[model samples]
Target: MSATIKDVAKMAGVAVSTVSYALNNSPKISEETRRKVVRAAEALNFRPSGAARNLKKRKSETIGLFLNDLGGPFYSQVIEGVQEIVASHDYNLIVCSTYGGENSSAHRFLREKFVDGAIIMGTAISDSLILQVASESFPIVVLDRELRGDYVHNVLITNEQGGYDAVAHLIKLGRRNIEFLSGPSAAFDNTQRYEGYKRALLEHDLPVPKRIAMHGRFLEAGGYQAVKLLLASKRLPDAIFAANDEMAIGAIRALHEAGLRVPEDIAIVGFDNINLAPLIRPALSTIGHSKFEVGAIATQLVFNARKEEDVIILPTQLIARQSCGFSGGVSEQDHDNLVASILHVGGRTKH
Candidate 1:
């Protein structure tokens, strides 16, 4: 059997409390006594229990990060940003996926306070659960969702304005019959982008499509299938705005297979300027934002050490690449225009 603290105490001819104080380097025990206890522990190969130490201090020195899934290139930068902050503070980062909702290990971590604080990035975890668990002592930083609570800080992306600008750009290029390819209806980001799509059409006096594509998986395959179905309808829109780059890439593939040309026959735009967006043929016009900054800011909020409810909304930029066939790329003048538009929309400045 393995040696325990009792074994060390007996071996050193000292009390169990003396053994603990010696091991923990308590000042109550003399340096000579500490050395003697340490020698005994080393002889017996006695190691302290981390769980016991944590229970004593009431601290784990760990941070929990809840994500939808660790798929695609989207989370790499976010994780890096989070790691940068976590490593500096000497804290361990535990990333978990909420793929199974309440039954998932991630949800259990949230419910049980497995870490000192939490950074939530997905909608799989319910709002009620978050509100119930968040307290003044146990703060939470949520990304892309707006939920008000005593110690909940929300870090949001400027989705609505980004969406508006993307669709408005298409409308200005004379693509009136624009089709909005959407993700899950309940998704906050998706809903906000779709709202911008509708607003652009309404502002320009264009008829919004009575029926639109819905329930995208926000993956490449989901984009492909949605476009294929739209093609079958025999009514193709002049422009397609996917809620994300993956879906837009999928739509391009579907259109290519059907012998339709991009921008010449149909224009396309996407959100989230993922790395793959620029590498793809014809390139993808996308709404770009600093995902790394989002992760970093959210983590900083977790360590704010106050009960003030804070909200940080990161600004999004419109990247005009080859797909939209507008200007092929954004010029300095266009960048100036983008800043003006963003200011007009909500006065959000970059961090």
Candidate 2:
């Protein structure tokens, strides 16, 4: 049989009300008496029910972290940032990937008020649903998308600027025939990035080759397949700008297998500056931002008491490596030394 609060009170030689106050850390009880009650409860192996405590306090002290999918290295750093902030705030975080937004668990948790708030990063959950559920009592913070509601806040990266900088760097390297490997058509980030790419090309009076603009789906395999299709067409561009680093790496592998060299035959640039970008051969020249900061800031917004809708846009910077053939007229050794020096000086390049 399980020990009850009465048993703890009896064991500690205290009244039932005194036991309650002690266990709940009420100021009405002395510290010494609270310690005594706690010791008795521990000795009796009395575990307080979380559901009961939540009901009494009317606060779950938990938050939900919703993602599109859990199978990428990109999410790990973001999760770390969220976890750090949530822990510091004395709240538990539940991570759920909706896998295209059909996750019953996510739906249940949100509807049932199992969490105090949610930090949502996936697109599967419709904006209508978020708007319906978000109230002043149940605030929500959305990442990567712009959502406006009384209780909703948005945290997003400057994806358009990142995309523009990436393409502009390629154009500055004298590559006019630049191809863009796009991500999913439904993704807002992809749309913004493509818009930026188009804007840069238009500014430079470069032709936007509609035929070469292929979808990479933001995956390595997608990039590889897209490159294969481009090769099959027998019409290659002077350079390619993949929407993400994973696609860029995949394109590099595919180009190498087809007896083409990067930055010589076809220069390449990518966005997202993922961890593997620097480690890869002919290190990726890409747009970089702190995914960790994005996660942390989003989580913080969820906890904020401001009822008005707000938007936070994080900035991004361009990271130049060897892949884009922009050595600035320096020798290969000198360029490498310069890159090392930049890294040592704490520039945007990832370690």
Candidate 3:
């Protein structure tokens, strides 16, 4: 790894600022100290970054993207889309995870104004913190969360409608006793999806049993455990609607472990048509949206200086596949057709 200024400072037995002064040939530093710093830097093959130096004086011309975790495939397309927009404008992208809430690096980045703007998707960072950091000079675009401020913009999905569609599709497949595999209760998307599930069941005159709703915490492991719990009770629903693809995948694993057949014994549907959805056995039926478009639009809105508050609501689409016993399932060629007719509803911007 390349040596930093701190390494030079430590080698020279001086403060970091002192080493900075010596390297920059400042009058404040003694000749002996300057030579000492230079010799240490040379020994470590250290070189300072001009762009980083310039950041101390003015705008960094970088965009920060904050997320809860960086492990899943869901972030891949979103990051790619953000990078596309960022690279086009000759700007840099810095991705940070807010795993530790305010104590994490994300908070430091926002508080210090190291980046020119931010695109936040993590719920760990509080709304007050975002509001505190955002201004005319530092624009912010948040995903899937609601907040109103002078320079803050929102990009949201039709989560409730997507949830409704998933349940309605199951209903069409003759799945009356449907179970809901929920994500975190605090999550806006989770809450909205749960609402849609209830709405669909009520409209269909089906029993919205509390016992059927299981917490999957939006994780594969969580989904697996949730289904195991239901299996332990010796009462399983005819169908299940997972809030996200990860949980649905996990549930499938659990069902297989129990020697149960998908769709034949219990139908399943999931949200977020991730890349693996089609590859899985009995191709997963899911609620689909343009994750790439969400990231691209959020990046575009980072530079958007609107006089009024801006909230962009993207549309959702239902993908039919064999998992729900809906059809033969989506072929590799039909993956592009995931958007379907629902996309015609179009996205709208609210002020």
Cα lDDT of all candidates, in order?
0.85, 0.83, 0.86
TM-score of each: 0.84, 0.84, 0.81
Over 41-144, each residue of candidate 2 has an lDDT whose tens digit, in order, gives: 99999987787778778889998998887875678878887887899899999998786345567877777778889988868888988888897668999988
Instruction: lDDT for model 2, please.
Output: 0.83
Q: List candidate 1 segments past 4 Å from native.
A: 1-49, 328-351
* Candidate 2 ranges beyond 4 A from true positions: 1-3, 9-47, 328-351
RMSD of each: 4.9, 5.0, 7.9
**Better model by lDDT, 1 or 3?**
3
Write model 3 residue lDDT over 261-341, tens digit each, in one string: 998999999999899998899888898888887888889889775535689988777888888886543443464654433
Candidate 2 lDDT for residue 57: 84
TM-score, cand. 3 vs. native: 0.81
Superposed by TM-score, candidate 1 places the C-alpha of residue 138 at a distance from the truth, in angstroms, of 2.3
- Top lDDT prediction, candidate number: 3
Per-residue lDDT value at 33 in model 3: 90
